[model samples]
Target: MNTLEQRYQFISLLGQGGMGKVYLAEDTKLSRKKWAIKEIPLTGMQRKQVISEVEILTKLNHQHLPRIVDYYTDEQQQHIYVVMDYIEGTTLQEVLKQKGVMDWKDTLHYSLQICDVFIYLHHDLAEPIIYRDLKPSNIMITKQNEVKLIDFGIARSYNQEKQDDTIKLGTIGFAAPEQFLDGQSDHRTDLYTLGSLIYFAISGKRYDQHATTPLHHVAKVPQELSSIVQKLTKHDAGERYQSAAEVKHALYKLLNKHDNNKKEQSITPMNIGTVMISVIATHKGMGSTHTAMMVAHHLNKKGYKVALIEANKSNEFKYIEEDYDGKQHKEVQTSCFSMHGVTYYKCEPTIEIATVIRLQYDFIILDIGCDLNQAWMGEFRRSQLRLVVGSAATWKKQKILDFVQQYEKEETKDWVYCIPFAESDQMLEIKSELRSKRMYAVPSNPYPMKLQEKTIAVFDEVLDHLPLNQKKKRLSIWWLLVPTSLVLAGIYVMMIVRM
Candidate 1:
């Protein structure tokens, strides 16, 4: 008997079924690479069917699909083996058995990954391939938290003109009703199985074939997700999503809405460390609002909780806000709003507002306009970062130069950062000239500020150097009492307004 010992070192038996025994093996030539080899006793007739399936597997190139490496028969020709990429993780069925049920977020994430794999199989392929056996046992959750589809033993190409599959295929619980009725198994068949699979993963309960309300008994499932799963599992293929792409889009929408709602609900006051940034204009006609807006927009896009406040006496960002939809926050008096996932406030940097905002946001950028008086300068001096922004034009450069020279002599000069706004072509020259000073220059960015890695790196360098407050303020009983009372008063006011 010739075993696989010549080319591959067998590690252990992975699993066995009626079809074959799978072994964890490592290639002798590529010792570091591991593979799963399925050994099946095949007669002469069985070889032809397996060859056709192997051709399809050999051509598959997807991140989530297992890659077939090689196939060989021993000297006796009684058994043949199929070698494939070893997915190092438990099956979804095993995960559910051990963990009971998964959180909706986790279930949704896994489901979306599975949907992406199906999208490739059904749409991206030359001929749409139907994964007839769609079940948790066939889906591997890798150690790296990636979902890998395995066991394409019964997968077949879908011919749109055909009326039905040649054979009935799929697991009993997860299979669509059409699969048993001699009806065609298409994209919708996979969607049906996916819905049942998701329901099982989330609820920790087996999907009941007779149950009309699959997700109804699972209370923790979000209403939005419930609606999607219900539609996907509809017995009638016409009622379900037409393609895997459609299911993915629907799930993505729910995820986005869930994230936005999570952000909205987290307005409670806490002792979170926050950095207050002051973007002060060194000269008139300098783009202070522009600088503040751009910086805040970038930070927010970088996953930081940022709020841009118009603290200048003149409403410099007025035009910008008016152009916005102006429906973020309904409190007309506060003029506080959210746009482009960043919050903006049209209010002076008063002590009370500043203190409250410091608790709510990671970064609060104050657009203090062009007026640098004693009171304004005093407030700017206290900030963790105070930037003097101005134009780089010859006339404007004089004011910036004078301001930098005078600023160097100040006690809080280390906190001062200079940013000269120049045309896109002059950024390199401006940066080189101001290299000696702790200064930054702006490159021309597209309007509305789309997120860019390079732009984020620049902002990251600026933020990383800004010193964090290390001294925790010891609070007296009165210190806590005041905020507690304020919270109660605010709650009362909200209740009264509702009445």
Candidate 2:
């Protein structure tokens, strides 16, 4: 008997894959414990990858993941092997095949368990781990109905400091759009796969990554589940849930709603359209940055997706931009990121990119570094709101009035709002001097303060004026008028000819 045979007894072959063959084995020394033994033909590159996986596994201990029992490296024989707990039941792929499709309740149950493993892998560890490959075949369901993730061959610890691509590994229909590009894989990459898995479990159909319509439209999936899936699987990584914790939170909400049978509480998707607002400084000292930041944050708190943009040529946010991830937008020239509950972008003052940004967010807060000028006038005119900020100084107030009077059209006046930075007395003084009655005053606190009642009122006013996306009205039978008209014309001609 060989030395390897001394420790374990091979029962039978279970399965084989491109990388290795797995066998059913029993540990001879430990009460004949059942284990899975994977045998792989060593190639130099694959040998290094296997070693890396072992290093990662040594540090991981999770209920949902398989525990590493033993590993062997035989350089002379050009082969290597690993032993781990043999899951008692079948793979999710097999289960799906047998059952056709799982019920929403069961699917949600499995999805929540998967999220737990993801949170543990991405956050609990000292260094975040990116599960490069996540698919049905890699997951096993034990007799106890517990899920155990098996393959870690391609998983790697994510390097947040590095912005370049380190490695690319994923399965078709499960890989995020970033993996196919020069993009770095992070926590969001695994989120994309989770979305695809949920889609498959519910629809019993493979996900098409490029599909536009929501899952609810094509299948029996619920709208709430479908909406979350859409966000998770979005091609743009920034648009996806920021972290596994966030995804778990969303899933729990849906689970609670379903369990409570709150059918009437079902959410109707908001008709949020593109509403762009520009907050430009009337002078250098006026607080454009503070005003724009506050307003954007306020809207975000109201559940609107708002993006605060630094479009000024001076790039006033240079200090803030210094610490953001460098590899954020490798393909795109511009830098856009989400932080502290708000998305921020440093962009050139041009209409082209503004149009693109408008489509993605419900509102864009443009910090026109300085007073509005010709460079951004085109977009300013088209914007839903133009908020000009200035100090309480008479010169600045006059400048604001003159600017608005010259450029503000009679038809566009309703879209324009003004904010004056001042103290209690200064604000009242500015109101008397300023020509525009639509002006709102924001208190100047050298230190941070809560959103003031005046600021909230201003935001509420703005929201009231902005249009909401109404449910699209379906075409009625009235559209048949043209065909009916033609039919009547033909009948009249036939009658005339017969006469």
Candidate 3:
């Protein structure tokens, strides 16, 4: 075929299957943009099936799924052409062939990504979709290490009325037993395939049902990961993980366990002191104070002596004290208070951070607000971890870019960019542009004083590699009152009063 719809120019054939052919084509109508054109021959009855597939593909909007741009039927060619994003990457199968076997950590990373896609397909959609085929060949790993599920030819919507699949379709090794037994496949079927895929990814061996071999026997996989894989590959669908979310949670737990072990092993005697976290924002109203409070409370709950210091001249902490004390009058002044096991210090402009560091808190969270001026830059630079909270909105995105550009000269490995209320796609785009995985989406927390699971999870990932101070000591009430005297004594203070 020379060209289809007088727009897409065929460049080269990408691949061919029993269904049809996929070509790497360029859209002449859209500035010569590259796209994958799928040409599937259609019979009279098969046209309806192709139409249903097109409907499902076009409606999907996900970061891990390919976008379907256009579809058309060429009656003379007797084929339906579907246009989609040209994914530039190597298949997982090719990677396995080149490397022989993958590291267990890499396998777990890709598995978690696949679980995210599965969760979106199974639970996030209006009608659940069960991916009937899942194998290394079907999974694509981008240059940036992002996982993308390429083909959806055999994917079908879940139907409670049907007891069995009308058409049984799946690969031999990766397909669950139910797929070939005339039994209906559900979300659990995909989980089973994920198990098989994980096994092959780590060991470079196909999973066999008849002569079952434990993953640990073939590969040096972690015990937790092996247990999760075993549970996922159970012969009975009921015995397997019920949903992709469950599998994801299990994988995350395993990852955390591995990370905690590494942290413990890497800890040294010199690094066992107090760790400071500085929280700042690109601009005002970007949730710096809220993010600091959330982290402080979370660390406090984890049995750390967490002190939230107002490192900037913001009234956020003073307001928080007033609100907590049930005093509506603005005349009430409390420079220091303790709530929820976290000590809050409302520092004055002359308060010195060195003095606070001498107090020996396990974790000192400096809420610097949006003040990136030289006055607060010293404290921000001294912190072990620096969190820059910024808006993810399109108009406000430039603020974050500007902030990064200003600090480009400094070492940024300790810096983390946080966008509040950011969607998955937004976070992915920003992360790609920034070329940093330290970026995280801060979940919405209406009550910063209370701990939320989602928010805590973000912090868990952020602080996973950091060594925690094992020497835990409770904060005394006298230590809280010391900040009040320091502020009144006209010493350097980082006065933080709530908005």
Candidate maximizing TM-score: 3
Q: For residues 381-496, write the lDDT of model 3, one tens digit per residue.
A: 87889888987788888888887888888877568987899999888887777677799898889998786888888888887756654222224556777898887765434343
* TM-scores for all predictions: 0.54, 0.51, 0.56
- The segments of candidate 1 whose C-alpha lies over 4 angstroms from its true place after superposition are 41-45, 75-78, 264-499
Sort by lDDT, best first. Answer: 3, 1, 2
| Candidate 2 residue lDDT tens string, 211-280 | 4767786677679989999999988889999888798778867866775586443321222255788876
Higher-TM-score candidate of 1 and 3: 3
TM-score of 3: 0.56
Cα RMSD of all models vs. native, in order, equals 18.5, 20.3, 21.1
Over 4 Å off in model 3, which ranges?
A: 207-211, 264-499
Better of 2 and 3 by lDDT: 3
| Candidate 1 lDDT over residue span 1-499, tens digit each | 2347477778889887656788888777553457799887767786766666676766775656776657887777787788887887899889888899888888877887788788878987788788877788888986546688988866788888989887676788888888889689998998898988888778775675324665746648678788888888888999999998798778867876776687743222233356778888877667777777778887777566777877776764545554553223332322454556566777545434434352246788888877777776776787778777766676566676676667666753454444544664454554455554455655555464564565556566666665432122324666888999999999999999999
Alpha-carbon deviation at 153 in model 1, angstroms: 2.0
What range of 10 consecutive residues in model 3 has the weakest lDDT sum? 263-272
